[model samples]
Target: MARNPAPFAPFEWMIAWRYLRARRAEGGVSVMTWISLIGITLAVFALIATLSVRSGFRSEFVSTILGANAHVTVYDVGRVGQQGQLDRAIADYEGWAQRVAEVPGVTRVAPLIKGQVLISLRDSSSGAEVYGIARDDLKSLPGIAQSDQAAGDLTRLDEGIAIGSGIARAIGAGVGDTVKLTSPNGVKTAFGTSPRVNAYEVVYVFSAGRYDIDRTRVYMPFAEAQAFFNREGVADELEVMVEEPEAVNALTIDILRAAGDRAQVWTWRDSAGGFLRALEVEDNVMFIILSILVLIAAMNIVSGLIMLVKNKGRDIGILRTIGLSEGSIMRVFFICGAFTGLIGTAMGVVLGCLFAIYIDPLFSFVNYVMGGGVWDPSIRGIYRLPAELNLSDVLSAVGLSLGLSFFVTLFPARRAARMNPVEALRYE
Candidate 1:
C-alpha cells in the first residue's frame, strides 16, 4: 500500500496544538504564549484605534473648514493702500458674482464686507470679526441652511446683528440684548481718526461648532455694514461656494475670466493647505511608529519559540527517530506561531472595530472615568473626538502584524527543525 505525504499533516497540527497548551508543572512556553498573544493583540488594537481617530479627526477638520468657509474667495487685488490694506474694493461685484454663479460648478456667490471689531456688553468685552452679508445670502449658506441645529432666527438679521454663540457667551449678550461694536477703521473727524463705536441688538446667536469662528464672528446686514465700514457701493470680496470643493481648481479659469483676471482667488486649500499637510504628515509618522510597535510585539514570538524548542528537545529527537521528517517538524512550530498570530489578530480586529463603531459611547465612558474634559473644542477646534474605522487601515495593520509574526517566527522554527536526533537524545 502506497501512502501520500501531505504538507502540514494532521499529526503536525495535533502536536503543535498539544504544545500550545500550558502545562505549568512541566514548565512549557505557556507564559511566552500569553505574552506574545497579548502583545500582538494590544499592538494591533492600538494601531487600528490611532489610525481610526486620525481619519475621523481629518474628516471633521476638512468638513468644518469647507462648511463654515468659502470654498473659493475672490479678493480685489487691484491697489494696495498706504495702510497695507486693499484700498480698492470689488466695485462691480454683483455683475461679476452673477457671472460666476452661472459657471457650471459655482454655487453661491455672496458679496461680503469683513473687518475686525471689538464687541462689548455690560461687563464683558472681546475682539470680533464682523462680516456684512445679505439675509438671503446668509441663509443660503450650507453650514447654516442644512444644519438641523438651531442657530437662532435668520429673521433677526433684518433689525440686528447675528452673533456667534461663543461671542454671545463671551460678551454676556443674548438675543435682543444690545452689544457695542468698536472698529479701528472708523470715521475720520477733525481728530486724525476716531474709533467708530456703534451699538446693535444681538438678534441671532449661531454656533459654527468651531472655537475660533464662534468666538469671534458677528454678521450684520449688508446695508448696515456699508454704512458702518464706510464702503458703500463696494464689497470686500466675493465668497463662492462650490459643488465639489476638492476639485475647486478645475473652475479657476472660468472664475478668473468671469470675475476678470484682476480679481485674485483664494481657495479653501490655499488658506488651510499647510494644516491639512501637517495632519497627513502626522498620520504617516504615527503609522510608522505604531508599525514598529507591532513588529516588536511580533518579535516576542522568537524568544518564546526558542524556549519552546529547548523544552521539547527530547520529544523532538524521539519524534525524528519515529520517522517524522524535518519539514513536518518545521510545520509544527510554524503552526504554533501562525496560530498565535491569527488568533491575536482576529481578537484585535474585533476589539478595534468595536471601538471605532462605538466611538461616542467609548469616548463618553472615558470622559466619565476621567471626570470630563476629554475633548476640548477650544483647543481641538471640534466639538467631539471622532473615530472612523476604515477597511484599508485595518487590512494594512493585519498584514503588517501577521507578516512580521510569520517572518520572525522562522528563526526559532528553523532552529527546531534542524536539531540532530542523536545530539538531542544525548542531551536528554
Candidate 2:
C-alpha cells in the first residue's frame, strides 16, 4: 500500500512550492519572480501612501475651517437697510436665537458682529476682518479658548481684543500692547466722513493654526463691538453649531423655518464649497491614476509566469507522463503567481503603514537636512504633512492587487495545463 500522504499535503501545492523555491540552474525563474514581486510591492506602496496623505490633508483642512467658523450661520435679512430697520431686526435677535436653538440638531448658538477694519500699531497697519463675539460664547469656537499660544484669557475679554499670531507679528504687537482699530463704516460730520477709531489693549494673541485666520482675524467682546460700530442694540449674524456638520444642509432648512423668513442660513460647506469640491475631485483622479499603476504592475506577473511556463516545459512533460492531471498543473502555476503577489502585497502593506505613521518626523528630518521649511505651516495652515492610514484603503488595495495577480495567471496557467506531453518533450 502507498504510504499515506502527509496530513495536509496536496500534490499540486507541493509541486508549486518546490518550483517556486527552485534555483535558476534547477528550472526556477528566480529573476523574473523577484522583478514581478518588487514591482507589485512598489505599486501598492505608492497607492496606500498617497491616499493616506490625501486623507490626512482633507481631515486637517476641514477641521481648520470649522475651527475658525461655525458650521451654519443665520443672517438677519431684515436688518439689511437703514438704521431704524436694522435696530428693529437686531432687537428681535434674542427671540430668533431662542427659536433656532429649539430646532432639532441645533447644538449651540452665538451672535456675532463682523466688519472690515484697519488695525494699527505704532509701527505697522493692516486691513483686518474683525469679529465681535460674546465673551461667554467665545469658548464655543474650536480654537478660540484653547490656544496654548495665547498670552491672555479669551473668555475674559472685555474692552480688550484677541488677535491672531500673524496679525501680532505683522503689526509688531504683543500681550499688554495697545492697537488702534478704525472701522470703515464711519459717520458723516459737518466737515466730512469720520472713521470710527478706538484703541483696545491686546490681551491675547491666538494662533488658530491656520494661515488666513492668523493673518487677518481679530476678536473682541460683542458689546464692545456693538458700541464701537455704533450698532448698540444689534449683531450682524448668528453663528450656529449643529450636532453633525455634514448634516448642516438638512438642518439649515430647520433653522430657517424656526428663525422666520427674515433670516437666511448658510452652511460651512457653502462657504468653502469650491475648495472642498476641488479636493474631492483630486482624490478621485488620484485613485484612478494609481489603479492604472497597479494594473501595470499586475502585468509583470503575466510576463514572469509566461517566461516560467516556457522554462519549465521539460518538467511539465515529465509531470504529465507521471499522471498529473491538467487541472492540477494549472493550479500549480496559479499558486506560484498568487504566492508572489501575496508576499509582495504583504510587504507593501507593512512598508506603507510604517511610512504613514512616521511621515511627520520623516518630513521634519528632511526639512532639517535641507535647511528649508519645506512643510510650511504658514502656507498650508498645517504644521506638518499629515497622514491617516485607513484600514479600508489598505484592505481595498490588497484585494485589488491579489485579484489582478490571480487574473493574470489564468492564460499562462492554461497554456501550461494544455501542453501535449509528446509536443512538450519533442523540443527537449
Considering every candidate listed, which one attains the maximal TM-score? 2
lDDT of 1 by residue, 227-317 (tens): 8998899999999998999999999878888888788899999998999999989999999999999989988888889999999999999
- Clash number by candidate, in order: 0, 0
TM-score of each: 0.92, 0.93
Q: Pick the candidate with the highest lDDT.
A: 1
Candidate 2 positional error at 328, Å: 0.7
What RMSD does each model have against the real structure?
2.4, 2.8
Total clashes in model 2, counting residue pairs 3 or more apart in sequence or in different chains: 0
lDDT of 2 by residue, 186-303 (tens): 7768987689999999988887768888899999898888877776787788899888987688887789999887888889999889988999999899988988998898888888
Which sections of candidate 2 miss by over 4 Å? Answer: 1-9, 78-89, 376-379
